[model samples]
Target: MTADRDLGSEARQMLAERTADLQAAEAANEALRRANAELRASRAALAASEARLRLALGAARMANWEWDPIADVVTGSEGREALYGRPPGSMRSAPEVLAAVHPEDRERCAATIRRAMERMPGEEEFDAVEFRVLHPDGSIRWLRSQGRITDRDPLTGRALRAAGVTFDITQRREAETRYRVLFDASPFAVIVIDQATFRILDVNTRACRDYGYSREEFLSLLITDIDVLGDEAAIRARGRAHKTGERTQEFEAVHRTRDGALRDVLVRVEGLDLGNGRVTYGAHIDITARKAAEVELRRSEERLRVALEAGGLGAWELDFSRRRTRWDARLAAILGRERVDAEVANEVLSRCLEPADLPAVQEAFRQAMATGGDFAAEFRILRPDGEHRWVRCWGRLLPDQHPGHRRMAGVVADVTEHRQAEERQLLFMREMDHRAKNILAVVQAALRLTPRHDADSYAAMVEGRVSALARAHTLLAENRWTGADLAALLRAELQPFLTAAPEAPEATRILLEGPALTVAPQSTQALGMALHELATNAMKYGALSTAGGHVALGWEVTGEALRLRWEERGGPPLAGPPPASGFGTRVIEATLERQLGGTVRRDWRPEGLVVEAMLPIGTIRAR
Candidate 1:
């Protein structure tokens, strides 16, 4: 029985142990199943992550690549061939990849790769290169590659593999080229400067030419160096203000060139934010000529002002389209009106004009406007003070490119003095005509009244009378037909008799005493004829017939009449008045009494002859 009980115990122990083994096996199987499920889940997550990476690379125009130096082969993502402008699998080998590189860049690319593969200890195994690739279609593409050694031989320390990313940079490069072209081709001088330092960073071709500096030289200068004022601190402050939008971008400043020539420039600045810092782009436009023109224009205007003031000219303008009239202060003074900003109505101007002159002035302006010609008018204007003035105006149309917008500008001047002079001249001419007629009538009367003796004697008498009248007429004309001087008339009529006695001086032969008085034109003629007759008779038969004879002619104003006397001495005696009424005696009496309204008397004295006359002052004196 003990032997049998021990056997059961052993069996049970073995069974329990087997049961424990079985349970452990089942637990091990469950762990294996959970591990498998976790792995599958991890794989799916990894695949999705890879898909996201590929999508990002594609969007960025990038491709992952691997290079095997030992095998001389290359591999990459699906679109890696496109970056090199090649078909899929065409650039699988290193040599094929090299052949696709542009001839200009192949050697450089190979050198870069060789350098990266030979990286020494303690040195970075990374490399970057930008190169071009040419395609079969005669097109080229630009690419950038960045890589690091992925695997290397431990003993040889040589690169076995490299991996990196490549991307298309053609668009970026083309944009840079276009910007460069435009920058160099700008018409206005352009410069790029660093905002912080005010240093010139870059300059275009125009900037170099305008500043009289080379591109390299300009790049070395500070912006303040070109400022003629050279206020560095203020300029820097302004630049800071511009960056902060505290000041306007455009300003005028004088800039100096390399040759020290100053230019008036209008500068316009634009701020560019380049992430690293702010830079300024400046454009300079030279306005030196325009500034000079403005100065000259001001000088010209000043000169015009001076000339107008000196000439007593009033400037005026009329704008027909706007119905506005503008005039300078002088014009307002001329029109006797208070100052106004602009004359708005034609009626206002018309009120200052004489009613009779307004129509003609209006017609002149109308004709000028119709023909686009000049306007000129002379008219009488009534001032506010009730003073009448004559004025002349001249105007011309201003040139205009647009129709119906004509403007006329001109000058006006007061011509009252000129008009008065013209009227006086006309009156004087008429007076001269009347005087000539009177003179002709007197000559006719003398010819008719003279007696007819022998033909030669009669002609001589007529010529003598006519000559006397001519002398009187000449004296009247000299005085503008106003009057003749009495002393001058006496001297002229007695000149022949006084000079006939050459042995005796004129003072010894003749005496003239009279106060200076202007005789009327009519009285001068009558007295001149009477004196001629008496002097002729004296020469022929009285005092002048002898050399020792003398004559005294004198006049004085007494009350309202003038009394004149003629006396001859030291000559053969005149027995009495002529025996009969003679032509010379009658001429003297008729001229003095009938023409001058005066009385004449003769005395026959033993020594010589005497004559006396009395006339009303009104008839003898010049009025």
Candidate 2:
């Protein structure tokens, strides 16, 4: 019974141990199942992270690459082929990758990789390089690669593997090329300067030419060195302003060239942020010629002012469209108007013109406007004080820069004195012509009327009459041909024929009596001839035949007539009127009656012949 009980216990104990082992096995199976689920979740998370990294790399135009130095192999992500301008899976080895690099950059890239692979202990294994790659389309592209040794040989401590990223830098390189092209192609001088040190960093082709400096020389100079004023403080202030967000600054400054010649320039400074630091781009526009022209223009205007003032010239402008007239103070004075700054209405100027001159002036202006030609006009103006003045204007059309806009500018002057002088000269010419004709007519008449009984006597008579005319002309000329004094005329005609008596001088030989009256030029000629004939008769046969003889010529103005009597005494007496057809008597009658509108009568007196004449004052006297 003890043996059987021990066998049951052993069997139950064995069964419990088996049950424990099965439970432990079930527990281990559950743990294995849980671990499998966690491994699957971790794998999914890892896959999602890798996908994000690839997506990021693709978006950034970058690709992951690995280079194996020992095996001479190169491996890259999916987009690495495109970055290298190659077909998919074409770049498989280091030699192929090196062949893809540009011929100009292949050697440099090989050297860089070799150095990176031979890196020593405690030294950086980082490798970075920028190079050009050959594109399949016969174009070159820029690329940047950065990597480090991922694995190294323990014994040699040398690089065994490297991994990095490559990206497309073609766009950035092309942009830099375009910037350089524009920088050198500018017309105005362009200079690049370091903001902090005020040092000249670079210069364009124009800057080199304009400043008379070579490219090397320009690069060695400071910005302050070219400033003629050398105001370093001001330059620093401007730089500071630019650094503080001022995008642009402009000013006028004088700059010196390499030859030490100063130039006037308009400088425009623009701030550039080149990632490293702030720099300034200065564009200098030379304005030296413009400044000189402005100065010359001012001087020319001043010279014109002086000339105008000296010449007594008055400037005027007429705006046809606006119907307004503008004039300087000098012109206002000439027009007898108060000086005003504002333009006057055309009607105001027209009102100042004489009625007879307005039409002419208007027509001249109209023709000038119509033809776009020169304008010239001379007219009379009635001043406020009722004084008449003559004015002249000269003008020409202004340039026609704008179509349909007509303008003329010119000068005006008071020409009253000049006009008067011209009129005087004309009148003098006419008067001289008339006088010459009249004198010739008189001389011809005398020559025809003189008797030809003897050649000597006829010639003498003609000469005497001509002498009388010349004497009268002399008196007229002395009075500017306006008129001849009556008394002076009588004296000139009779003075040569007078002779002194025993007790009396030549002054008493003949008598002339008249008031201070002047005879018209025409009347003087006629009257002079008559007086000469009478005096010749007197000296030959009348009172003046003897030394003691005397003649009295007297006149008095009455009503509208001048009554004169020529009385002779103490010499030959006149028997009754001799032949009425004598040359001397005919001449006196013709002159006093036909020419002078007067009556001539002779009274035969016992003492001497007495002559009386009644002359119309209007016909003989000067007005």
The candidate that wins on lDDT is 2
Model 1 / residue 481 / CA error / Å: 18
Residue-wise C-alpha lDDT for candidate 1, range 1-623, written one tens digit per residue:
99999999999999999999999999999999999999999998999988988888888889999989888889998788877777898988878878888989999988988888778745655699889988678788889888988887889878788899999898998998799899989999998999889899999888888989999999889988998767778886655655535433877788999999999988888888899999988898888998888899999978988888888778888888877788888878888887668576756777889999999999999999998889999999999999999999999999999887889999998888879877856866786677678768867877887777688887988888888888888888798677999999988877766664667554467889989999987688888988999889888888878888888999999998899999999889767777787777887877788877888888889888889999889999998
Question: Clashing pairs in model 2?
Answer: none
- How many backbone clashes does every candidate have? 0, 0
Candidate 1: C-alpha lDDT: 0.85
Residue 392 displacement in candidate 2 (angstroms): 3.2
TM-scores, all candidates, are 0.56, 0.53
| 427: Cα error in model 1, Å | 11
496-585 per-residue lDDT for model 2 (tens digits): 876688777635888787798889877888888899999999888888888788999999899999888899999875667676557888
- What TM value does model 1 have? 0.56
